[model samples]
Target: MSAPQYLVILGMLVNVSFALAAHGTARTGRNNARDNLVAVAALAACLWWGGFFG
Candidate 1:
C-alpha cells in the first residue's frame, strides 16, 4: 500500500521473472551456474532492501 511495499512487490516480480527466464534458458541447453547465481543475487538484494530499508 505504501511506496516501500510497492517497490518491494516490484522487486519480487523482477526476481521471479528472472528466475523464469533462467529456467527457460537452462532448458534450452544454456544452463549455467553463473546465470543462476545472478538471479539468486537479485532476489537476495530485493529481500534485503525491502526488509531493511522498508
Candidate 2:
C-alpha cells in the first residue's frame, strides 16, 4: 500500500483506540485505562494528515 493508504489505516486505528479508551474510562469513571490515545491521534492528524491534508 501507499503512504496515503497507510495513513488512512493508522487514522482509523487511532480513532478506534480513542473510543476504546473512552469507553473503558466511562465504564469505571476514572483515568485508569493504560493507553496513549492523544499521542496516536496527534500523529495521524498532524504528522500523517490521514489523507485529508496530505
Candidate 3:
C-alpha cells in the first residue's frame, strides 16, 4: 500500500484506541474522556485528508 493508505490506517487506529480508552475511563468518572475524543477526531480528520493531500 501507499504512504497515504498507511497513514489513514494508522490514524484510524489511533482514533479507535483513544475512543476505547475514553469509554473505559468514563466508568471511573474521570474527565479526560472529552480530550481523548477530541484527539481521536483530529486523527480521523488527518486520516481523511491524507488520502487526498498527497
Q: lDDT tens string, model 2, 18-41?
A: 666675454546553244566556
lDDT agreement with native, every candidate: 0.66, 0.61, 0.67
Write the residue-wise lDDT of candidate 3 on 1-40 in tens digits: 6887677668767766766666645455764656776776
Enumerate residue pairs that collide in model 2: none
Q: How do all models score by TM-score?
A: 0.45, 0.44, 0.45
Candidate 2 Cα deviation (angstroms), residue 46: 24
Off by over 4 Å in 3: 24-54
Compose the digit string of candidate 1's lDDT tens values, residues 1-54.
578767766776676677666664546486565575676677768777777545
**Model 2 weakest lDDT span, ten residues long:** 26-35
Better of 1 and 3 by lDDT: 3
State residue 10's C-alpha deviation in candidate 3, in Å.
Answer: 0.3
RMSD of each: 5.0, 5.9, 4.5
Candidate 2: RMSD to truth: 5.9
Q: Please give the TM-score that candidate 1 achieves against the real structure.
A: 0.45
Error of 2 at 42 (Å): 23
